[model samples]
Target: MWDAHMHCHFSGDSDASPESMIASAMDKNLAGICFTDHLDYDYPNEPDAFLLDFESYEKKILSLQQEYDGIFPVNMGIEVGLQPHIADQNRQAVEAHPFDFVIGSSHTCDRLDPYYPSFYEGRTEEAAYRRYFESILENIDTPVDFDVYGHLDYVVRYGPNKNQNYSYEKYADVIDEILIRLIRRDKGIEVNTAGFKYGLCAPNPCPQIIRRYRELGGEILTIGADAHQPEHVGYAFDQIPALLKDCGFNYYTVFTARVPVFYKLPD
Candidate 1:
């Protein structure tokens, strides 16, 4: 198994150290894992914003690679929040690193994090959802500089009106545009299973969107648990093969030096 997205203590929001996370992956018999620590730049309101110490973190990851070479394949990765107005700053930060994988994410919409209820103040649930999707569409056109876009529908998982009805089909046009832009830029998308943990039937960028991406000439896809804790690593990975097969994707993607490499899903 390959867990393409995860975080360790090197990231601010996570407390799981690299050693502990590697041990968990080893216990699960994963073939490889990537440490995609948070790298959100200039996120307002987060004083000690969740971020990784890139220089030191990369050094430590390289050291661990030597120690665990025979046990499992470990890769250095970073998860960066791609905010529209700060694209330049975010791009500069990523260019400074020698990451094996990069996951671009959008955690804030219009400078407000939907994770906080205040973001939805005075706005109807439908409007709030629409704004979130718009934010994604806006950022998609701003020269993305990462391997894959993370949890495209992450806002839904924490929306104020959680049970509100919304699906990819409703925003297929916008999503198609986003996928095409990514494909043109040689970027990929991730199937984040964290959605299931939040009571949703499917993960972010639901199966419908996955199918849409494939239909739109997208072949590279990555599966991630978006784990913040050791136990969460590789969660529900057993179902990934079948899911990819169902979406007409025979291969899953990994990265090294920020370049994508494909792996056939085990039969």
Candidate 2:
């Protein structure tokens, strides 16, 4: 399997070096991996925090790719934080780079990042969750450049009660709109295993959403660990094959130079 979403020191939040992350993926026997470091322009309270230094970051990735050539495949990718206002900026950022894969993600709700407890203050969890899903719809409605939507239910990971009160059924209307729009746009979603790390006991968007996506004629699906460190590189990936099969997917996807490559799920 390939761990398509990963971060290194290039992503402001992660301290892991790219080499260490690739080495860890190798140790785990992954077929290949992608380095999707963050390029979250205009992050709340820290606008420049996740801005990627493309020159230096690309240099390091190129150097390592040469050294590890034939040993393993290290694909270059980025995770862009999507917002309605900065849709043009996000598109420009992706166009300027030759990233193999791009993950468009909603990291904020009306400029407020749900990561902070303050985001949940004074609001019912259901209300906050609805607003988050609505923001995703707005983001995708714009012309942002991205291949897959990252962590469809990321906000729930930080909600006051986390996923305890969350269910795809509770918010099926908006979520279905999001899925249908994505399929129409030829976009895909990633099964982010980070949810398991955050105590959700399932991947982001959960199995229910994945099954719904398939039912909606969504064909492109990617699986990623969303790892920021070596140990987490491919975290819980072993459970993916079975989980995806249960969701009506017999294949998983990877990207190269922005093109989808399908691989049959291992039996």
* Tens digits of per-residue lDDT for model 2, 1-267: 999999999999999989899989999999999999998888889999999999998888878889889999999999999988888999998999888999999999899999999888898999999999999999999898799999999999999999999999999999999999999999999999999999999999799999999999999999899999999999999889999999999999999999999999987
Full-model lDDT for every candidate: 0.85, 0.94
lDDT of residue 266 for candidate 2: 84
Of the candidates shown, which would achieve the greatest TM-score relative to the real structure?
2
Best by lDDT: 2
Pairs with steric clashes in candidate 1: none
Name every residue pair that clashes in candidate 2: none
Error of 2 at 258 (Å): 0.2
lDDT of 1 by residue, 1-267 (tens): 689899988888888998988889889988899999998877769835876677789899999999988878999988988888878878888888888998999989888888899888999777787788778778877765888999988888887656368778777777788889889978889999888778776778788889889999998898889999999888888877888789889999989887788898987
In model 2, where do residues sit more than 4 Å from their true spots?
none
